[model samples]
Every structure is written in structure tokens, then in C-alpha cells.
Target: MNNEEKYKKNIHHIHDKSYKDLYSKREVALDLFKNISNANWSKDLKAEDLTLVNNTYITADYEEREADIVYKANINNSEVVFYILLEFQSSVDYTMPLRLLFYMCEIIKEYAVNAKHKKYDKNVKIPAIVPIVLYNGEQVWDVPNQFRKMIYNEELFGNNILNFEYDIFDISNDEKLNKDALIDLKNVTAAIFLLDQKMDAIEFLERIKVIALYFNSLSDAEIKAIKKWIKNTVVDPLAESAIKILEADKREVELMVARNAFILDEMRENAKKEGREEGIEEGRKEGRKEGRKEGIEKSKLEVVRNSINNGLNDDIICKIANVSLDLVKKIRQECEKN
Candidate 1:
């Protein structure tokens, strides 16, 4: 890839890495799962029972797809795969269900291969996969959650058609994510979600102050992780002006909050000044146009008056002065009265 493409890819990779690093923490992962709406199955499960599993899968087309997070957990005496798809795109993926299906099938195929199960082996027990998509996009996710919804004439096939519904956690949407419970639980993942939702740098910086309150409750390692994520995903992408103010005092979250209060007010004043300058520039352009138009009208009236004084006939004056015959007549009548 060229430098620009490589830069974009690296930026996207940074986002993926930051998210992977945060969720890989057992505490954060467990907290996310427990907060999933109608997820009573995970209520009885503990941290020890949840094992991180391989996420890279090769599809039938020989294309490799790496899932964000995958966990193996025994729920109700059955081995189940919890495939958490961390989606950070700004727009909704229309083929979300199909993407989930492809990943799930690959997971099952890998499971069968590892277990040494024959093609038609009835003795081999396939692990049930609970595919969950965690989206932090700006737009509301409008994609179909069920695989059957993507298939044509699915209703006609009835039970014969393969179908499964994936759970979606729109982290930006409070209705989808139990924000109150997660906040009450002091989950770091909730803080990440809340920060990710604020696209504006000022709003993001403001939210960091609220998130800082949880630092005392978190471990040093967790605090470090949050800082790293912010630097890589949030702060680095900001404009140089904002970055200067934010980086004024060692870039510490607590220190920055205190310094930024004054900085924010100054930034708002600068924005107002810029707006006023733009309005003045626009008004100057309008004024110039009006002046030019008025000058042309005055010149036209002068030509009509001169033609009248030259004793030129109406039709000749109309052609020479480029004024209408009616205007020539009006000028001549005015001269007679004077």
C-alpha cells in the first residue's frame, strides 16, 4: 500500500488494538457480558470459566477474517462460543448478519477439525456460538440481526431454512447499553463507550473529567490502558490548536481538565471572532456588487440624457446609447419641461 493508504490502515489498526487491549482484560469483558440485556445465561458464569479463545478464522473463499474478541464459556452444561464483534465504523454495515454467519460457520468448522470429527459424525458435539456485535458508530444500527432476514423467500422455507439471530450492543445508545448499571458498577468499558461517542474534541475532553473520577476505583494498569487508548485513538487525531492547549501541562488527565476550562472559553471566543470575520467578508462582497450595479444604472441614465441634448432622433438615440426608445422619449419630455 502507498503511504496514505498505509497511514489509514495503521490508524484503523490503532483503534482495533486499543479496543482489543481494553476488552482483553477479564474484568472489562465480564462486565460487558453481564450488562448485555436479557443475558441471564452469563449471570451464573464466573471469570475462571471464561477462557479467551482463538479469533482468527479462514473462510471457504480462503479469505482470513479476525474477530475482535472470542471467549469459550460453559453455559448450562454446554460449551458455547461468545464471538464479540467490535465494530467502530461511522456508518452501519448492511450485511452485518451475513458477516456474523460467515464468522460463526468458520468457527464451527475449526472446532470440528480440531476435534477430529468426520464429515457426517453424529457423535461430535458442535459448540453453539452466540455471535454478538458491539457497535460504537454514530448512526443508529438499522441492520437486520437475523440471518434469515438476508435470505430471499426465507418464509417459504419455514424451519428448513437455516436462521440465527445475533445480539447487538449499540454502545452509543443508552437504550441498548445499560449505561446506568455499568456506571454504578464502575466498569471501565462504560467509560470507553462514553468517550467514543463524543466526536467533538471539547466534549471528549469534558467527559474525561467525569471518567477520571473512576481512576481511584481502578487499578494502575487499568488507568494506564485508558490513557494509552485516549492518546492513540482520541487525542492524537485532534487538531494542532486543541492539542496544544490539552498538552499544556504534561498531558495528565487531572491537570488537563483544570487547564482546559480556561482554554475552552478562549477557544469559544476565537470561534466567535472567526464567524464575525466571515460575515463581514460576505457583506463586503455584497456591497461591491451593489456599487457596480448602481454605477451601471447612473451611466445608462447619463447616456440617455446626452443623446437627448445632441438633438438625435429617438430611434438613432436608442441604437447609439443602447437605451430603450421609451427611455429616450422620457428623457426628451423631461428636457422640454426643464
Candidate 2:
């Protein structure tokens, strides 16, 4: 099946547990929020607790309110607990905040009904819902990296109320972080960042050792199946789909590299041959122009001078000039003397 298909399969079991854990704890979300938290993700956040979390969660959940992943954690003296709902996606969802609010409402209704059905359970706390988005897409989905703009309203009179009800952490796929900084992020986050680099899809996926290792942790059967699919869909024949849309661009880049190498090789070969021919011609002409002894000497000097000016390094110039160290030194001395 395709990547989108696999994503929609509800095979949460296939997802990395650490990834799930990070989503629940908001470590990844918080890191991203430091850069991209917006107004939409914080609708129900009453005052302060929604902004931070550092405590033992009562329970982590995924089956709550039809969200992709949700976690119920206890913080704030372990008394005031809240829900941290996380959504993981390859593309952006425009209706996320509204959807999350509706989901929160549904969760409240469910709790109220459940209390009625229960034998003896205390009143439902109506815990706050915090939604975070982990977006991985080629282009940005939202306008601002943060979602603060969504909740604010500009009134006609003076400054209206400021509403930052929710928080969102959009790990921009296109944004490139340095290797050192990338290494510090959660391994999967780093893997996703690396995957966005320009490279062959097959090689790109292979280079992500963490992602591969995480998947490989699955059963042998699951690994075998994933390998087969990747081989066929990503690496084998159709594996070239990564650059399919950008075929011309890819070809142009390859051509540039090859073209440079070819031109350099041609220039070197031609220069070598030209140098030898020039040396021979000067040797002959000098022999004829000057007396035999001086002519031969001038020819040797000409060879040495031209080789030096050819841009070749000293070692290469010496080899091509075919002059001993002493002779080269003498030629240089003679030139300086003249």
C-alpha cells in the first residue's frame, strides 16, 4: 500500500513507541512550540497549566475523541490533570483547531454520560485539551510558524481581547537545522529532517538509520514485509519516483557534476600534450637561432619557464618540464640574473 494508505490504517501498533511517548509528553511538541506554538491549539487552556507540563501523567491515551494520539497526564501537584492530544501527519490540516474543540466537547459529553452510567465515580473534572500538530510536508501548511493569529479578534473600538487558547508545534519539514542541532532532537525528528534533504529516495531512506532501526524493531515478519514493499515501490524499478517530478532538475544537477569533471579532464589532457609540443618546438627553434650550446640552453630555459607559468603545481611542473632539481635551480638563477 502507499504511504498515505499506511498512515490511515490505524496501525498505531506499527508506529514507534518512542514517537508515541514523545507526542504524549509533548517533548517534541514543546520543542517545536518554542518556535511554532499558535493560538488555535490552546482554545481550552484556562490560565497557566496548559502552557507547561512536568509531572507523572495519570494515563496516556490514543483512543480519546477519535484523535490520532492522545495522552492524559497528571501534573500541578498531581491533582489537576489534563489531556495532551497530539496529531501526527504528513500534510497539514486546516480544520485542526475547530476539530480539536469539537473533539473536546465530545470528550466532555462522553464523560458526563459515563458518570451517569457508573456505579460510584466522582464528578468529571472536564480536563483541559491541548492539541499539537506534528506536520511533515514539503511546503508550509499554516501562515505563521506559530498559531497565535487564529484566536485573536480585532474589535472596532480599542484593542480586543487576546486569546491564545491552544498551542501547535509544526516541525517545518523544509527548514534545515545544522547537523549538531539536528542530532540533539529526538532521533525520529532528526530522521525526518534528514529525509527532507535532497537525495535519491532510496538512499535518503537508507541513510536514516534511526528510522530504519525503529522499524526493524518490529517482528521479523513485519520487517520482511516492509522490506519487500520498499524494495518494490521505492528502490527497484519505480524507486525513481522521488525525483520523478523534478527529473529535469535532477538531470541538470547530474549533468553539471559530470560536465565539470569532463571539462577538467579535457583541459588537463590538452595542456599536457600542448606543453610537450611547445617544449619540443622551442628546443628546435632555440638550437637553430642561437649557437648550438646557447640554443640548447635557451630551449631548456624556455621549457622550464613555460611549465612554471602553466598553473601546474611545482611537483607536476617539475615532472612535465623534465628538468632536474639543480637544472631548475640554475634556470631560475639565470632568469633572476638576467
Candidate 3:
């Protein structure tokens, strides 16, 4: 697979693993549910009250889709199920509301089928479903939260239109949950999402050290899974070098010091190389007396375009091309139009 696809796959894998690892435990799941849902009933519920449902609703047609998580629990003295859908794509999906609506319908249909097999009374109440979308993409989620919002000109239909709103936990924004209040695996998962958005190698490594403090409390298997995730999703060369240093040591604090030093050295080397290249390019441009300015501008634009095509971030492209951020953004916008 290409780098972009591999990156996305690794991210999804990490997310799936981390989520299941934490949510499978009743205590952690209860805390997470209470924090995210803010339901009055969750305040009095214990871990023993929750039960995981292993039913798979994904059909052959939807085989390409990731399996969503479901949990059956008793809340407020009533039976209910929670459907957790994860969206980690770089861009927002406008059809998410419709997709969730379809999934909820399938879940209810399955419940009905099972109820029939049990010979349930016609007056029996159906279990309520609470759907949640956990999104961690860099872009803001601007899609409609309610199914009715997806319908065109819903105002005309007024109260006749069907509607249900799903809860969203957007990790990109800090307004959702207080990360400091979370414990153990939940805190580490939040740190992972927060660190993923940081582009600086030093800052990322420093944050990783904070996450490592909780590693000693986790099982060996969990540690291995998290380490594997770091190796896969963190593709920055400087960050990779720091990870290598950190992995060599056992003590978290010592490893943090070692990683910081390694990152500094790597950053310096990269900066020196960039400077040398810039100097060489400048020398070459100066040699061409005719159309020198135009040639330089054309070369810079070409470099920006190539970097964008190669999936480089704006900061890196700006530094490499020795151009302003606005120029890089303009070129990216123009490229997108084409």
C-alpha cells in the first residue's frame, strides 16, 4: 500500500485497539460513558451493570467498512444499547448522518428479529439506542448531527420529518472533555490524539514521555500494542529517531532525556541540510542573469507543488521552498481546483 493508505490503516488499527482495550473493561467504559454522554443515569451505574454485545451487523456489501462497537447496558432502570462509531479520516464525511441512521435501523431490525424468536409480547417496549461518533481528524466536523438535517428543505416538512441526533466527541477540539480528569488508558488515548496533531518533533516526544508514565500500569500486551502504534503512525523522521532512542531505554525519565537529545541532533542536521540546498539553489539562480527572478519564482512554485503532491505538510513545504506560508497555501488551493 502507499504511504497515505498505510498511515490511515495504522491509525485506524491503533484507534480500534486502544478503544477496545479501554472500553472492554467495565470501570473504564463507565467512566468514559459518563464523561462523554453526561447522562444523569450514568452517575449511579457501576461497571457490573454494563454488558458487551458481540453481534456483527456488517454484511457482505459493507465488508469494507470497519466494524462498529456496541454495548448493551441497563441505564436509569431501563435496558438500552450504545452504538459507537469511529471516524478517523483526514476529511469529514458529509453522509455520516445518513450512514449512522442506516446502521441504527439495522440494529433495531436485528433486535426485532431476536424478540420475535423469544415470543415477546406485542406491547413490549423496544430498547433505546444511543449512537455516538468519535472523531479525531484534523479538520473540524461541520456535518449535521441530526438525520433530519441531511434532508433537503426540512423546514417545509416541519414536525412531520423524522429526526434523531447523535452525540459527537471531537478530539481535535478541547471543548469536549477534560483530558486531565481521565485516568489510565483513557488518559493515554486522549494524549495520543492530542500528540498526533502536534507537528514539532521535540514537542511530540515530550508529550509521549507523559503518556509513558501510565505504561507501567498496563499489561505487556497493551504496551506492545501501543509501541507498535507509535512506530506505525508516527512517520516523521525526527520523531522516528527519537522513538528509537526512547525504545532503547527502560526508565521513562531517562528515555525522555535521551529522546530529547536525539531529536535536537536530528533537527539540527535537517536544518543544516536544508540550508545547504537553499544556498546551492540560490547560487544556481544567480548564475542565470536573464529571467533570474522569474526562474527562481518558478522553481519555488514547482518545489511547493511537488511537496504537496508528495503529501508533505505546509510547514515543511514552506521551509523547503524558502517561501512564505501564504504562497504554499495559494499553490495548494490552486492544485485542489485542478
> Number of the top candidate by TM-score?
1
Query: Per-residue CA lDDT of candidate 2, range 206-257, in tens?
Result: 4333344332333434333333333332322222322222223433544433
For candidate 1, give the lDDT of residue 222: 63
**What TM-score, over all chains together, does every model reach?**
0.67, 0.38, 0.65
Residue-by-residue lDDT tens digits, candidate 1, 269-307: 454455455555555777755645554555556655654
Clashes of each: 0, 14, 0
Could you give the C-alpha RMSD of every candidate to the true structure, in order shown?
19.1, 21.3, 6.9
Q: How big is the positional error of residue 118 in model 1, measured in Å on the Cα after superposition?
A: 6.3
Candidate 3 residue spans exceeding 4 A from truth: 1-28, 59-62, 75-90, 117-122, 177-186, 213-232, 235-255, 261-265, 268-274, 277-338
lDDT: worst 10-residue window of model 3: 81-90
Query: What lDDT does the true structure give each of the candidates?
Result: 0.60, 0.44, 0.60
Ranking by lDDT: 1, 3, 2
As a whole number from 0 to 100, the lDDT of residue 329 in candidate 2 is 52
